[model samples]
Target: MNTINTYRKKRFWAAILVVQILLFFIFSKLSIAISMFERFFEIQKEIHQLLFSWIPFSFGDMLYLLLGIYILYSIITFFKKKTRNASLFKILILVNIFYFSYQIFWGMLYFQKPIVEKLPEKEITLEKKKELALKYLEKCKQTRAVVMEDKYGVFQISDVHKIKTEILSQQAKLPSFISSKKAAEINSLKPSLFDGVMSFTGILGYYNPFTSEAQYNTQLPSSYIPFTLAHESSHQLGFAREQEANFIGYLTGIQSSNPELKYSAEYFTLKSLLNSIVYEDEKFVENVISDFSSGMKRDWAYEKQFAAKHQGFLNAFFSFTNNLFLKSNQQEGSVTYSYFIDLLIRYEN
Candidate 1:
């Protein structure tokens, strides 16, 4: 009877290992499928306007509810499951640890190469690049002014419904953005895992041209959330280029009546603009920095303090990931940001 029981235990352990391996393979294949699917539509320039042409609910708002439920369940489970002996709890904890370990080992295995490809290369002349970025910025300002003045910047769900009404009302005037067939396809893309994120709320979502998702940090200061959301959402709309997304998101937020959204937009754009200028001319940066409004200065200080708390983690993660990103993207350094200078100049010129 003892030998029979031992044999059963051994079989169970082996089966568990096999199940884990299968899960890893399944996750990897699913990741690949998502990547391939994103690319198929991404390469099409006209696909942007149709992306959110139809959706039942905003993805981010639903995720908030889901996360809330998960947290509540975890709390309830903790209180309900009180074990008298710590050994049983420890064993259960180890099982959880093993599961998490297996997930991390393979869940993100398919992402590194694509992420690396998005890193900026140093092939372009810095001076010329700045010129290009400035040109783009100038054009963006004009484009933004037109969009803001003409279209409403929706904040709440009510606002979104209102906008939809306006769009439908002007169907005659609305240029056919997509063919009837493609329109159906775009509308069919319900807000899934690929859409709606509370991670960063500025403009971009799962839209990194390279990684197919936004860079999200949940532990960030609450202050940065709105802007981050907009930024990432912009990426989702096929704005594979960073500066364009930044510019569009800033415009979108600034156009909104919401004070928080406006502030986020202004803060992000100002930071990008000032940083560019500062890098190009330190004396100019010093003068501009000294002239900041007291409120702006306070905000800056708050951001700095908050950022400092996460600096070590950011440094380690960025250094490693950026290096990989650069290598994958055929770049020399982890300076994906530097390309924005070129983008700025392109826009300006």
Candidate 2:
């Protein structure tokens, strides 16, 4: 009886996995199905935010913590003769439930449609990328001077709450052709509970599909927080692609009345543009970096110091795993910044 029941358990999850894989393949090719899923996501996001957004703390982070603990407990008990079968069943059930929920909530949106298809097509060129880089470099310098700074002269957001408000406001203003999803007004963004560890992992922020919450590391340098919020909030807007989120974030921030949000967004664009052109024209990139104003230089220096402090094996491992995760979801991977630059250049022209 025990062996038969165990076989049934394995078979049930195997069937679920096969069904999900088939659905994913179909979704990738079926626009109508993808559109239906996008609508489902809108309804799901509303329900999730209603349940979780009111909590001042991160319920999603706690959910992750408890999940980790449960998994660890299962692993420890798996070696025990009396508990091995039960532990196995528990983990299997958990995996199946989470996988199915994740797909139903967020995974299908990755296959909906690429943002580039909605925009005017144009030839991407090296010259155009360089021009944007110089433009953003100057913008960053000017914005940096205007935004508040810390006692040490590094860039600091004057008011995080205002930035959050501005990001939400700007979301509603995004071009209809770009993002047609209903704009979310719920303040679901929260600071992560794993911020101490996230700093070393190089994760800026992540959107929680299950809870419709955006989680950012509170430990980030002040300059990174506002733009990171905008970027993560883009994910909440149903953009599953990383670069698309960045592009949406750029749109969200570039038009904001808040200087704090504008400075962070402009700086991020400058960095992305520079990264895009550095290999093609290293000299130009260096010269542009050298031209940073004293305030911008101090801000850059502080960022470098923060990154240096957290550099280690964990950063590399997280980066590698993150790249794989992105690619699995049809993204261009974290190592590539040109997709956002591609959107930028095409949109600019």
Candidate 3:
């Protein structure tokens, strides 16, 4: 009788999981309802901040660690036990709970109105991209000249705390036409505990929806860190799409008075434009690359070296999985920068 009751419970949870999946599809079609999530964001932020922000270490990272261990232990138990039905039931319940919680906390934000729709309409041309690439190259070079550097003469942030503070402050300054979400002042950013693993996987940063914290890989090159923090924080602001987060990150970083933050944003902008235009004009790309100042050149070299060191099957697998995840969430994936480039061009025009 106990075994039969366990089977019924498993079936019940399985049905709930299926229903939640269907509901997500239904919610995806309801933009107005999804936008309503923005109003609740402040409440969510406050709750999470009150719970986790005071902790010096990353509470989200610890949660991930514990969850990973539980999953492994459950899998081992399923194989070890003669009667595996109970273990399987537990696994089903775990997955259902996770999926439901994810949808409630963050997944609904994916259905919010697209950022591209908020921008001015402009025809993006290859020539325009090339022009912007050159323009930002100069901008990056000039800004790089002023930013502090390490002993290697590569760009380095003098004050990360200040950058984090400024990012929060700049969130309030975003154009009202583009963003209606409240910008809560919370210092919930943390260095990821999985920095080593993240370095190998090419993930610079991520936002923990359950905790409302922005976690960045501390192993990344300094030039990549500030913009990445801005990008992840944008996600914390309830922008779920990758391209939209990138656009918001650019806006936040560029609007800051901090030279370190400004240079990183401009450098990323220049690189993104060049990446979009390189296939169309290799010579032009080469010419632009040659124009990078000495400091900027070293920073670029360091980034390239970091990528080279981490290139492997693991990185490829993670990239593929991440690409699928992005596509499933209505994004163009990591390899495609056109959406972000489009946003930048329209905004610039």
TM-score, prediction 3 = 0.98
How well does model 3 score by local distance difference test? 0.89
TM-score of each: 0.42, 0.97, 0.98
Q: Write the per-residue lDDT of candidate 2 for residues 1-349, one digit (tens) a residue.
A: 9878987887787777788778778776888888889999999999999999999999998999999999899999999988987788778778878988998799888887788988888888888888888899888888887888789888877778888888989999999988888889898999998899999999999999899999999989988999999999999988989999999999999888899999889999999988888888999999998999999889889999999999999999999999999999988889899789889987887
Q: What's the true lDDT of residue 201 in model 3?
A: 89
Model 1 agreement with the true structure over 53-155: per-residue lDDT tens digits: 3345444445445656755655555566442223334334445555655244223333323322333434445455334435434433333332221122312
> lDDT per model, in order?
0.43, 0.89, 0.89
Please, what are the lDDT tens digits per residue for candidate 3 over residues 213-327? 8999988899999999899989988899998999999999887898888988898999999889888889998988988899988998999999999888888998999999999
Clashes of each: 45, 0, 0
Higher-TM-score candidate among 1 and 3? Answer: 3
Root-mean-square deviation of every model:
10.7, 1.1, 1.1
Minimum summed lDDT over a 10-residue window in model 3 is located at 33-42
The Cα error of candidate 1 at residue 302, in Å, is 0.8
